[model samples]
Target: MNTKAFLEPMGSWAWWRSWFLIFFGCAVMGTGFVLFINPYNFVPGGVYGLGIVFHNIFPSVQVGTFGYMFDVPLMIIAMLIFGGQFGTRTVLAALFTPGYMNILTRLVYPDAAAVESLDPALLLGGRLDLSNDLLLTCVIGAVVIGVGQGIVVRQQATTGGTDIVAMLLQKFAGIKFSTGILLADGSVVLSGLVVIGFGIGTAEAEPAGWMLTLYSLITIYITSRVIAYMLDGASYDKLLFIITDKHQELRQFILEDLERSATYLKGKGMYTEAMKDVIFLVVSRREVRLVEQKIRSIDPRAFVVVTDAYDTYGEGFKPLPDADTIQAE
Candidate 1:
């Protein structure tokens, strides 16, 4: 198979824009990892999370170095298994993020010796010392990481790490993608429990290790929600099902006034045994009230139900994804 076939050609402006987003996203992700997640050793489940665990054991090695060690092999394996779908953008993001983190770490802790010590006071000159406020730190880190990841994902590229492992598991073991993510991340968190929680690395058992683990779970949940919100906006369209005698009038109102389309489903009333038309329509949240008012005006007794439509792709909505487009998530 020609790998080039999967690569989409872009105009100069779009090409620059895509690369900019990738670079900026990686930097943002690195910021979260180094400043918020790393200093206090909060394992949020990724290569970097594992890096934090390994860093506890090998203080000399930076967290980002472990990220590189894990990411390179994962990228190779993913490319082998999935082919050119693992494009240049993913490779750049995987490789660039760790280097950026290492640079940021050095900048954060100017003293070379302080890097290994993981001193909370030394980090950001004690300004961002959330040692007393772990929950706040977790929330900040998750939001920062989520925004960065969301930006990268918007460009249809991923910062390959455990995500590759999850995809591999899905392919080989028949595990669901989501389940694979849970398994991969769960193992990383569990390792933190053994290494950091039990004090295997520090030789000083941390009583707060379980609390940190719980906080990490909360971080993961918040990050996932933020990423979802970034991908799909906060507001969802409204879907309406209306059954009424004034079908023609409602249809005319929808078409002429609302300038929207609706589908009429032929139905039979269960109790009355009478034929009726069910008006099925999808409208934006703002237009929903207008639709309701119009419906009430037409027939006050019309049986109507309104629900949220999370994803609507059609002529007047989001375009369908291209068949050849590759989404690395």
Candidate 2:
């Protein structure tokens, strides 16, 4: 009755659906980088952020090209270090991102032979000198990036770049992925500060200031939140703890009717000093009402406690390891 078992037969509908989501997400993310983030010099971290820094220095090089340059090497390193962890989907995502970014730029500015030729300030009409609005620009661009990244994550694929680096670090150095991302991106942001020359001196082209640094941090925060919302929003699962004497009936309903599993724990009611059987399980938000109704039907006086299970990784939930990486023990 493991729900995960039924998914992902070769070339199945789910397979196509997963790839579609990953590609679509990559396009959205690439658009955000090329059109909004790169133009504004909001270095929010990752390959795209580094690409922005490089693009400012070498205006001739498209930001997507820079991303491609970095992503390929990093992906190779990931493959070498973590066998089976970096799969074809990751490769496709890494490759698709930069190419689509260039494509988006071309679509936005058709007359230009390449995205690099178009003026960076063209989208803003070069009005920023008169009214500096990096904050608003950062917020809008970060939201777009977050939406794209969230969609990619929902498909269980990464856009590569520092995401691969983070995984590698976690695998080899025992660093947590979250911590590794913070450190890697934090260093990138700091580098951006120096590259943009915040408060030191404004260059003739691509002026940088402390505001951009602050905005970059803010953008990262917003992007993380958006990803979380997309991955675990209203549909997040719930963990239930039910203390009931009707353990057999409850277990039967959970196993047969709900097609779900449960764990039983023997406990003593602290106040009543009576032996109690505690049934613990997690179910989707939509299943809560049905479960509650069943509980009430079986044991009206059952002590039920429900809590949010923000992330659950197991047989019927998210896989514990990266789809393409070697699963760590």
Candidate 3:
């Protein structure tokens, strides 16, 4: 296994950046849980989702404390099973996130009585109380949580809840990672349906049993999509396939005018039986017009195909993950 990612020189910019992302990401995730997810008892998955389910039964114990109860043991088991591949950053993120959640809960609900009682009405003076608009709340909460988790993942670390469980399932039970995650989170969501939705652990039964389940599914879907968007970036990059005769001129225009690069491929027209140069270029969405105009000016009959470049990585684009980072991941 490549160790360079985890063994980055201490005090380097990469090291500092990784640390910052971990802390900031964990804080944002905790904030999303404390303010949006936990108050509404939305079990969106992971240890926190289970914590929310259990919180209904034991309101006195904060969700973050439950996170610790679940994560610490999982971390130890993961280390034993996977060995050093776990990485220090992941362990730190897992440990720090729960504390952040617990602290944020305390800060958000200053009144001890309100906190212990798990009073949703007392949260943030009801500023975030969108109990009336559950859908909107779920979307916003999912986005916040997804962005935070995305940042942590980008730094080659994880918040380490159900992720470890998924890994374990994959290793031992021959379950696919994604499938394992779905099963784990799905169970947690189901638990919410039973515990909170059915009023099994509450003073009264919630009327929104199936509705809560649906909303939780929506939350999970949106959160996953947002996290994917965060990691892969916006699909606003345009890839151009230009079939033109003026290769030199177009190449000059791309290099000097556009400050971009392109690859040249030799091709032949099936009908014409003539050799040609295919210019493969990738540019931002805004640059497509300029490129098209330049191609037209150079070769009016240029056959240009433009498509979306969802994610690009290289010297000019996003930097590729280093070996150490990749291995750590």
**Which candidate number would show the highest lDDT if scored against the true structure?**
1
Give the count of colliding residue pairs in each prediction: 0, 4, 2
lDDT of 1 by residue, 207-240 (tens): 7888888888877777766666666777899999
Tell me the whole-model lDDT of each prediction, alpha carbons only: 0.81, 0.74, 0.80
Look at candidate 1 and give me any clashing residue pairs. none
> Candidate 3's error at 227, in angstroms?
1.4
lDDT comparing candidate 1 with the true structure: 0.81
For all predicted structures, in order, the TM-scores are: 0.89, 0.74, 0.85
lDDT of 1 at 295: 83
lDDT of 3 by residue, 78-173 (tens): 666665645566678899999988887888785988787666688877666688888888888988998898788777667888767766676677
Worst 10 residues of 3 by lDDT: 320-329
Q: What is the TM-score of candidate 2?
A: 0.74
Q: Residue 290: error of model 1 in Å?
A: 2.5
Score residue 122 of candidate 2 by CA lDDT: 56
> Ranking under TM-score, best-scoring first?
1, 3, 2
Error of 1 at 103 (Å): 0.6
